[model samples]
Target: MGFPSISKFLFGPLVPVLRIEGIITPNTTNSIGNKLRKINTSRTEGLAVVLDSRGGSTGQCQTIRNQLLQFSKDNNIPLYCFAENFATHGAYYILSAGNTIYVNPTSIVGNASEPQADIDFSQFLLKNQIESRIIASNPLVNEYRFNWAIKDSEKDKKFIQEITDRISKLILGDIQVSRGKNLKVNEELLTKEYTGKQAINNGLADQFGTYEAILAEKFPLAKLDHTSLTQFSFISSYQWNSRFGKAIPLFLLLSLFSLKVFIKYTLIIQSYLLVSSQEEGQEKEKKVQH
Candidate 1:
C-alpha cells in the first residue's frame, strides 16, 4: 500500500511498463513475454519496457532481447536500464539489444566476456532430424547454447570460446557506437568489474545519480518497488536468510564435493597404513622365532 501497485497500471494503454529487477530466466521470460504479447495485441499507446534484472539464462536473455527489439521497434518503445548495484556480463549483453541504454554515472555497466561454458554435449546423440538440421543449417551452437548439464568435449570448449569471443566483440562495438567517441574500453564492465568513474571514463554508462533523480527526469512519478519490497508483496510467500556459503557457484559446489572425496581417500590411506603396520609386527615376531 505504500508504493504504487504494479498490478495497478500507472500509465496509458500505450505504455506497458514492466520491471526486471530480479533474476531473469526462461520462466520469467514466459511471464513477461505473455504480458507483452497481450499489451502489443491490445495496441497500447506507447510501450516503455524497463529491464533491471542482473540476468539469467542466455537462451532466456535472447528470448527477452528479441521480443523487446520487435516490440520496441514496432511501438517506438525505448528500452533503458537503470544500472543498479551490479549489472554484469549477461546483464550488459541483454542491454545491448535495447535501442538506447541510459545509465546513471555511478551505475555499474560493462565488463563483457564470453559467457561461461554451461553444458557440453559432445557425445550427444541428436536424433536424425535434429542432427541433419544442425549439419544443414549449422546454427551458432557454440555461442551460448550449452546446457551446463552436459559434459563438454575439448572441441566443444574451443567452439564455445570462439562464439563467446564474437559476442564480446559485438557488445564492445555497441558500447563504442553508443559512446560516439573514440576511447579504448576494456569492454568487460558488465562482468561486475567496473567502478562508476571507470564506467563513465570508458563510456559504458552516461552519468550517475540516485534513482529519484534519474527517474524524475524521465518518469515524473517514478516510484520503484524494490525487489526486496516487491518480494514481500506476496505476503504469503516464504523468505530465507542469506547464507555466506550458499551463494557459491555450481562449479564451486562440484569442487567441494571432489575435495570431500579426496579427504575420504586420505582417511582410507591411514587405515591401510595402520593395518600394514600391525601385519609387519606379527611377521617380525615369527622371524625372531625362526
Candidate 2:
C-alpha cells in the first residue's frame, strides 16, 4: 500500500481522490466502482475524481459514467471531477457524469472523434516491401488483418458510420442532460476540441481549477485524525491490484518453500522404504541359501 492509501484509511475528513487515468477497460471501471462503493462519505465532505486520459473503450466508459451518476445520486453528495491533462472521447463522457467538473488552463476537455474501423498500414508495408494475405469466410473477420490493399466496402463503411453516430449521440445526450442550459450544444462545438478555459466558458466545465484547489476550498478543516487506526482505504480494483502486485512475490516464495519441503520428505521416505526392502530381500536370499 502507498502513503495515499494509508492516509485515506485513517478516517480523516479527507477528500477521496479517485484517479481515472490510463485506458478505460473493464479493470478500470471495476476499480472506480470499488472506490465509489467503499467510500465512507459520512466522514468526508465529497468525492473528487481526477481524470487524465486520452480516451478508451466506449462501452467501458459508459459503464463508468453510469456508475458515477448513480453513486452521486445515492449518496446525495457532490462528486467533483477535474480534467488534469487530456479528457477526451470516452474520458470526457465519464467526466460529464460528475456533479461538477473543473479543469486547468491547458487541460484538453473534449475530442468527440468517432470510432473508425480502418487503419492505414500502406506506408509501412510499402517501405518494408511486404505483401500480406488474409483468408476468412466472413469479410468482417478479414478487417482485423493487415491488408493495406483491401479497401472497405460501402456496406462496411456505412455500418461503421452508423455505430459512430450512435455513440456520439449517446455521449452528447448525456452531457446535454447533465449540463442542461449551461452547455450550448451545437454541431461545431461537439465536433471540435476545447481547452480548459474554453470548456469553462462553454459550460462543459463548471470552473477552471485543480483538484487540490477545490479540495482545500470545499473541505478546509479536513486534517489528520490520529485517534482511530482501524479504518481502511476505499476498496477499488486499483487498490486490490496494488496489494496483489506486491503479494505475488511473497506467495510464490511460500509456494516454493512448501514444494521444497515436500520433495525433501518424499525423497527421505523413498530412501527408507528402499533400504527396508533391500534388508528383507537379503534375509530371504540367506534363508534360500541355508
Candidate 3:
C-alpha cells in the first residue's frame, strides 16, 4: 500500500482539507456539497477550508456557507478557514462561517458589498454592428436582458437598487452572525477590501497563518488529506484553455489529426473485413462446386 494508505490504516482517517478555489457557481456548491456529505465525521477530527476566490453567484455562496456551517455544527468539529490570495464578495461570506479564519499577511479579505449588476453590452454590440433582439412575452423582461438599453424608468432603478441592497444585507447579516463579537469593524469598513494584516486588525480575520502552519498547530498528530471536488483532469483542461488561449488552434489541429487517424484505421479495418467476407463467400462457392 502507498504511504497515505498505510498511514491511514495505522492512524485512522486524516484531517480532510477541502479547497474552494475559483468562482462560486452552482457547480461549486454541488461539488462541495457532495464532498461534505462524504466526509467520515466519526473518524474526522477537524475540517479545514482553503478559500481563494474573487466571489461569484450570491445564492451559491450562501448555500455553500450554510452547508459548511451545518456540517461543523452537526459533527461538532472545529472548522477552520485559510484564505489565500483573495476571498472577497461572496467568497468572504463563506469564509465568515469558519470558527477561526486565518489569512496570509498579504491575503486580500472582505468586500461584503452588493452584487455588481450585469454589464450593459448594448453599446459594444451597437459599435460592432450587432443587433440583438429579445423576444419576451413581457416588454419589461427586455430590460433584464444583457443587450437591452438601460431602462429610463424610476421603478426599474428602484427595483435594481432593492435587489443589490437586499443581497448586501444578507451577506453582511451572515458575516455579523458568524463573526459575532470578534467583528470590530462597522458595516462600511466590512464592505471594503483589506490585506490579511489589516483584516486581523479589523477583526475580519482571526490570525496570520498558512494552511501548513494551521494544520501543524491545530492537528499535530493528524495527517493532512487535501480534497477537491474538481478532478485534476478537468482542472488541467480548464487551466489550459484559460492560460494558453493561443494554443487552442494547436489543440484543435492535434484533435483533427487524431480523428483522421481514427477514421483511416476504421476504413482499413472495414476494408479488411469486407475482403475477408468476399473471400469466405468465394470459398463457400468453391466448396459447393467441389
**Candidate 2 residues 1-290, lDDT tens each?**
56644444443454567788877789998887777766665655677778899778888888988887787787676888889998998898888877889999999988655555457676677689976677678867636443456555677566667878887887787778888888865745865679998888888888888877777777664532222212443444554565467668988999999999999999999999999999999999999999
Kindly give the number of clashing pairs for every candidate. 23, 0, 0
TM-score of each: 0.50, 0.65, 0.70
Candidate 2's C-alpha runs over 4 A off are: 1-12, 120-150, 223-290
How do the candidates rank by lDDT, highest first? 3, 2, 1
Which candidate achieves the best TM-score against the true structure?
3
Q: State which candidate, 1 or 2, has the greater TM-score.
A: 2
Minimum summed lDDT over a 10-residue window in model 3 is located at 229-238
lDDT of 3 by residue, 1-290 (tens): 55434433334445778889997899999988899887766556788999999899998988999999899998788899999999999999989999999999999999989676566666777788877656778877635533345423666667777778888987898899889999999888899999999999889999989888878777665557686422121223443445457657987999999999999999999999999999999999999999
The RMSD (Cα, Å) of candidate 2 is 15.2
lDDT digits (tens) for residues 1-290 of candidate 1:
33333332322122345566677777788876777766532323333445455666766766776787787777665655556665656566666554445565455655656466353443453532233123424645643346443455677778768877887676666555645653345454444456656765665655565444544566543233332222122211111112223435765988999999999999999999999999999999999999
Give the clashing pairs for model 2.
none
Q: What is the lDDT of residue 263 in candidate 1?
A: 99
